[model samples]
Target: MEIRLAQRVQALTPSSTLAITAKAKELKSKGYDVIGLGAGEPDFNTPQHIIDAASASMNEGQTKYTPSAGLPALIKEIITKFKSDQGIDYSPNEVVVQNGAKHALYTLFQVILDEGDEVIIPTPYWVSYPEQVKLADGVPVFVEGSEENEFKITPKQLLDATTNRTKAVIINSPSNPTGMLYSEEELLELGKICLEKNILIVSDEIYEKLVYGEHKHVSIAQLSPELKEQTIIINGVSKSHSMTGWRIGYAAGNQSVIEAMTNLSSHSTSNPTTTAQFGAIAAYAGSQQPVDEMREAFEERLNIIYNQLIDIPGFTCVKPQGAFYLYPNVKEAAKLTGYKDVDSFVEALLEEAMVAVVPGSGFGTPENIRLSYATSLDLLEKAIKRMHDFVESKMKA
Candidate 1:
């Protein structure tokens, strides 16, 4: 039987990060010693307190479906979290919980966009943004972010990209692939342009709690009350609380937009996982010591690995201030080693060195590759040593 799938399904690109991780797992299952540096989540377990909360909720018979938006108690906690962390106040009615931050983004695009609406996404974006926008039948317009700018686009760039059909702009500070962050001053400048143009802002701050050193995470919505009205903040416990598998995330924005997202979610996901919502409540309302410890660990790993990564022949990288990924430009390495492109370099690295890393082409930068440091320092050291030996051998060849 011939099956006809939707054209949109045919147009979608499978997530490259997941594909590489799965390949590494397959090789490991075959008794190969594959060191995977492609993961997006933390290596640590979910804090015992949060896990206990979920268990307690289940024991107390709280496993039933929640309100479409979320349990009211969890929504209140989200509101309080925004006020305390970002200095932005949100009422319970202005927040909606979803399956994950990824789903929060998908629901936002669905509620806000119409056919032909353009969303200006800065390049080297999280892999899912453009795909999710396309799923909503919206057009994604890209603005290239040069390595010189630490992969962040400027206010002028934003201004030049704006069109009458532009409906929104996405800002993912402490960005996924690059791990670079936008300063408060930078965000305020961009916010002014969006205000004048009436463009809605979608701020993906899922990595807000993962910053290192003196660098701080600032929500664009916190820049001012006016900008707050124009911005929708996407975040979840997936990264911050190490609850990736629990799938609890929420969106805070204008009341009308929140209502629309809630309505859409009702007909689609119904509600976020009920026990997970209870766990998320404890995550936000309880102690934050575990989050702090994980941040420190990531910082230590970054400090240990960054110098080693840059010391490799023909490799260059911008030191990331937040998140756990290092995006190093390997174009010179590819050229020096006789590979056709970064993708080929990545493929050969996996096959020959038994190391897994994601190519930058998937993240809209073909000159680089992303290495996740979410694993142990020992594994990281092993992976980098293998990579260095592989590149050195190619150079000698």
Candidate 2:
């Protein structure tokens, strides 16, 4: 029997990052030594205090369904977090909790976008942005952020891209694939244009706490009252607290939009898991020392591997300011190694060198590949050596 899939999903591209990760796992199961750098998750477990809080909630019989918007107590914690972290205030009614940060974004698009509405997604974006916008019957308008500019779109570019159909522009910092962050001056400039055009700013700040060196995270919503009114912030404990498996993320913005998202969520997911919500509450309210420790470890690993990665022949990379991924342009390496393109180079890397990396075409750029340094420092060093040895041998051949 043949079943027809929906047209909405027919043109949808599967996530390239996940596809390679799955392939690596398959080879590992078959006794091949495969090192996967395809996933962006933290290698750490959930903080013990958070786990204890979740267990305590269950023991105290707080496991029933929560409000569609979220638990009132959890909402309070989110509000407090915004005030402390960004000095931006969000009232209780202005937030909606969902399954994950990804779901938070999906729900926002569903509520705000009508058919044919356009969202300006900067290039080298998270893989799901375009697909989510399209699933909501919206058009994705792309503006390329070249490597020279650190992959951040300028305000002039934002202004030029503005059209009557432009409903929102996503600002992801520290970005997923690129790890670039927009500074205060940069965000202010872009915020002014968004204000002028009356376009919403969808700020994805999931990696806000993962910044390194002198780089700092500045949320566009914190720029001004008008900008705050115009921006919808999407964040969660997945990256910040290592609670990916717990699945708690939320959105904070305009009352009407949040209420709409909350209503839609009621019909869709009912509400996020009650126990997970409690865990998220603890994640925000508990001592943040563990988050700091994890960030420090990632920074150390990044410093060690960035040097090794660039030492490979025909490879050049921009040091990331935040997040755990390293995106290096490998076009010259591909050419020198005799592969037709970066995609094929990546496939050969996995099949032969036993290292899995995400080709940049998945993020709308084909000259580079993404590698995550979320694993131990030893594994990262070994993986880079494997990649270097592979490229050198291929060049010699």
Candidate 3:
């Protein structure tokens, strides 16, 4: 028998983070003491109220198919959330719910892009952004956001990347891997360029609520009516509400684009899970104390562990303003520990030190590694100590 796969599927790169996680899990299953610092979700459970809402919905027989885009109630909650959180107004026609924020992004690219169209992506980006763009037959144009600037692209950089085929640009504040947030001023400058160039903005704000002390999350869309009109916001409860498994994410943007995405989703997901939609509605409409508590815990962990991590031999890092990941430039650590690169160092750390961290190469930056603090304080401490000891033994300095 002969089998063939489509070129798009063939062109996809498997996630390095997931691969490392698989290996870590394999070791764990064999009773190895692996301390995984590659987590991407909150360590806490979903809020009790949200769980109760989903359970209540199931008990009350609310588990039938919903509107292809989402339940109307869920859409309404999303609308209210935007108004309250970002001070942006959205009509129901401009919002569409998808399986998750990842899916929301995937669907957005599908509807908005055509073959050979270009989307500008800042480097050190989330692993899935470029992949999703490519899946839509859209060309992803990468622009490096130097670590000196905390890995944020400049307005001039965005201007330089624009071309006749440029269709959109992605702005992921409180970014994954780097955990950097764009200032309001910075976003305004970039938004001006996009407005002049007529490039649509895809704003990924999944980590909006996880910002740390003295730093706040700002949406490029929140800058003005013009910017809001030019931007589509992709957000979900996964990171914000510890609802990773619920898979309820929504997009708010141009009515026409939203309509197309809704039509596309109808033929695909049909609808997000009914119970999960109910849970998301409750997540938005209920008290947000749990979200705040989770943010505080992450901040405490970041403050404690960032200091400890940088203390390790040959490691230097930018203190993240938000999110739970610590991205440290470990090229020196790699060299000092007798490894040739960050990827090999990460592998050796996992196998020898039993501390699992993600190599930054997957995020388009090979000199660094991402260590997620989305675990308990005790485990984070243990992982750092292991890395410290491993480096001390290998580096001898």
Candidate 4:
């Protein structure tokens, strides 16, 4: 029987990051020593306190389904976190806890967007943003973030992209792939433009806690009371607390949107895992030491590996200020090494050098490649050396 799949499923592109990671794993399973730089989460384990909390919840029979939105306790902790970190305030009714930050965003797009509504996404964006928007029946309008500007779009670019059909704009600071952060002044400029255009702001601050030296993560919603009302924040403990497997994330914004998402989730996913909610509560309310330690380690790795990456012939990388990924322009290297594009270069790297990194094409920047520094310095060093040697061999050929 020939089955007709839904158009949405047919149109969706599988995440390239996950694809590369899987390929690397397949090779490793077959006894090949493949060094993978495609990781999207912290290499660290979830804090023991969070694990204990999940165990305690299960032991106490808190394993039953939670409220579709989230546990009141977890919501309270989320509110406290926003107040302390971003200086943003939200009522409990305005927040919805989903399976993870990704799900939180998926729900947000579903609730707020109508068919034909256009979402302005700045490139190079997270691999999931455009796909998620398309899945929700919204058109994604791409605004290029040039490498010269550190991959950030200017206010003028945002203004030019706005139209009658523009429903929202996504802002991912400490952005995935590039790991570049937007300064307060820059965010204020962009927020003002969004406010003037009456476009909603979907701020993805999943990497908020992972910022590096001299750079602070600013929430666009925190810029003003008006912006806060117009913005929806997407955050999770996955990156911050190394709780990716816990599958707990939350969205904070307009009450109407949150209620609608909660209603949708009730029918769709029910509630986020009940035990994960308890664990997330511990993540937010527990000691800050573990989070701090992880951030320190990532920063250390970034500092060490970034120098080596830039020194490689034909590679140009801007210093990443946050997140765990480094997106380096490899177009010159590809051209120098006789490959047609970064994707081809990446494939050869994986097959020949036994190293895995995500090609930038999936992130809307074909001239670059994203290498995650979330792994240990030892593994990172090995991966970079392999990549360097691979490039050198190509140049000689």
Candidate 5:
């Protein structure tokens, strides 16, 4: 069978995290006590008020499809959230709500990128960005960032990656897999370059609220009025409100870009779930005490796991300022483990220590592994202990 799948599908790679998680689940079902460190979301419930709002909407017969751009009320809520949290301002008409942050990003590519268009992405980016660019018939130009630089790309590097065909650049602060957050000044410098180059910026700020220490998430659009006009700010309540299942992501950008995405939405998903939109409205407009409480807990666990990783031999990790993941370079450990690479190290950990982790190759970096400390403190401590023991054994060998 020739199996006529779309050519775009051929360019896409499967999610490494979900693959690991499925394997972990299989092993656990077979009576193995697998400690999963691969999941990217927090192990918390959606806030009560948000849940209530969804129920209320459903009871009120708000089950019909919303406008493709999203409910005007929800868009208004998103505007308020951006202004209050990231100091970015946008009119409701500039906002387009979709299924999730991922959806917004993919749609942004479809709307802006033409065949052979180039998108400058920092290396070790989210696993999906490169694939998304390819799916949209765009080329992804990677600018490598080292662990020494806190996994952030420099302005010079950004400039070098640009070409006349460059369509956009993605800025993910509190980045996933690495958890590196960019400072406000750093973003301003990059924003200035984008202005000079007349390049579009796709700012993924889903993890904005999860940052720690002095690292603040400043939307590059907020750097100035000109930058704002050229930036598409992608965000959702999934990370902030622990509302992953709600699927209420949105983008704020130039009216034309937003309108194009809205038209795309009209043909594809039509709209996000109506009840979820109502709940997201409450998530934004209601009290934010729940989000703050969860952030505090994550901060506490982050400190514990980070301090432990610093003491482990043959392993090095940058203290992630935001997000729940820690990307530790395990090349030293890989050499000791009789494993050829990061994939083998991850496999050995899961098989020997019952610990599940994502291989960094999925995010364009081998010789590293990603561990999510989004679980409870007890599990995080135990997972770290097990990982430490595994590394010690490797070193002894």
Candidate 6:
């Protein structure tokens, strides 16, 4: 028997981050004492109150299926969250909960994208964005952001990428891979371009709560009501509350888009887990003390790692304003080691230093790599030391 996969499925590649994570795990199992900086998740466990809320819900027999959109009370909480935190007013009916941020993203593409439709995604993006667009029969237009600009795309890039078949633009602030946060002024400029082009905005704010250093996250919807109508705001408690395993995420947008996502969700995952939804409700409603403490830990780690990484002989890193990852350019190290690219550089680092990092080539930026600080301070410090030693050794070689 022969095996052939669907074209869409064939187009999808396994997540590069996860593939590196698995390799790290395998090395760990072999007693390599690997330090995994490839993880994109928080190191902290879910808060006690959220766990208790899930238990309480379970005891209350809240195990039944919820409405395809989500439980009414949870949807109401999302509305309140958007209004209070993001300063955007969304009705409960205009929100749809899904398995996770990734689910929310894929579903949005399913509903909006058509064959050959183009989506403009700034480079150094999350690994899944381009693949998801391809799965939906859309072309992902890559707009480059360099180290000079802190890896952020300018409004001019958006204007240049716009075409008749360009259906949407993905804006991820406090971005994945780079940890670059967009300022309100920057977003306002880009939002104007999107509005002028009549293109939709898919704003992924999954890392909204994980920012630092006086960096404020501004929702495109908060920029203007018109932009809000054209925006699909994706967020969740996974990163905010360290509840990634619970898998609850949502999007707020036009009623038509919400309805479409809800309908697709009904036949798909049906709804996110009931207990997880209950837990997310508590995460949104509970005391934020835990959130503050976790953010502080991440901030401290970010500072320590940033300082150490940039001091390495052939490494240069941009100071991240948000999120827990640091993207460092190691082209000089690549040159010294004769590695030829970031992938070879990363593989050599893992083999010699037992430090796991994701190469930037996966995110469409070469000669750079991402290191997650979502680990212990001791581990982060040791990993930096090891990486520095490896780079210095390459220079000598």
What does candidate 6's lDDT look like per residue over 180-275, in tens digits? 888889989999988888999999999998889888888888988899998999999899999888899998999999999999999988888999
Please, what are the lDDT tens digits per residue for candidate 2 over residues 239-299?
A: 9999998999999999999999999999999999999999999999999999999999999
Off by over 4 Å in 3: none
Model 2: weakest 10-residue lDDT segment is 153-162
TM-score of 1: 0.99
* Predictions in order: lDDT: 0.95, 0.95, 0.93, 0.94, 0.90, 0.90
Identify the superior model by lDDT, candidate 1 or candidate 4: 1
Per-model TM values vs. the true structure: 0.99, 0.99, 0.99, 0.99, 0.98, 0.98
Candidates' RMSD to native: 0.7, 0.7, 0.9, 0.8, 1.1, 1.0
lDDT of 3 by residue, 25-54 (tens): 999999999999898999999999999999
Error of 1 at 396 (Å): 0.5
State residue 121's C-alpha deviation in candidate 1, in Å.
0.6
State which candidate, 4 or 5, has the greater TM-score: 4
- Candidate 1 per-residue C-alpha lDDT over 1-397 given as tens digits, one digit per residue, 9 for 90 to 100: 9999999889899999998999899989999999999999999999999889999999999989899999999999998888889888888899999999999999999999999999999999889999999999999999998999999999999999999999999999889999999999999999999999999999999999999999999999998999999999999999999999999998999999999999999999899999999999999999999999999999999999999999899899999999899999999999999999999999999989999999998899899899999999999999999999999999999
lDDT at 262 for candidate 3?
Answer: 95
lDDT of 4 by residue, 225-333 (tens): 9999999999999999999988899999988989999999999999999999999999999998999999999999999999999988999998999999999999999
The backbone clash count of each candidate, in order, is 0, 0, 0, 0, 0, 0
Candidate 2 clashing pairs, residues 3+ apart or interchain:
none
Minimum summed lDDT over a 10-residue window in model 6 is located at 333-342
Q: What 10-residue stretch in candidate 1 is worst by lDDT?
A: 79-88
- In model 2, where do residues sit more than 4 Å from their true spots? none
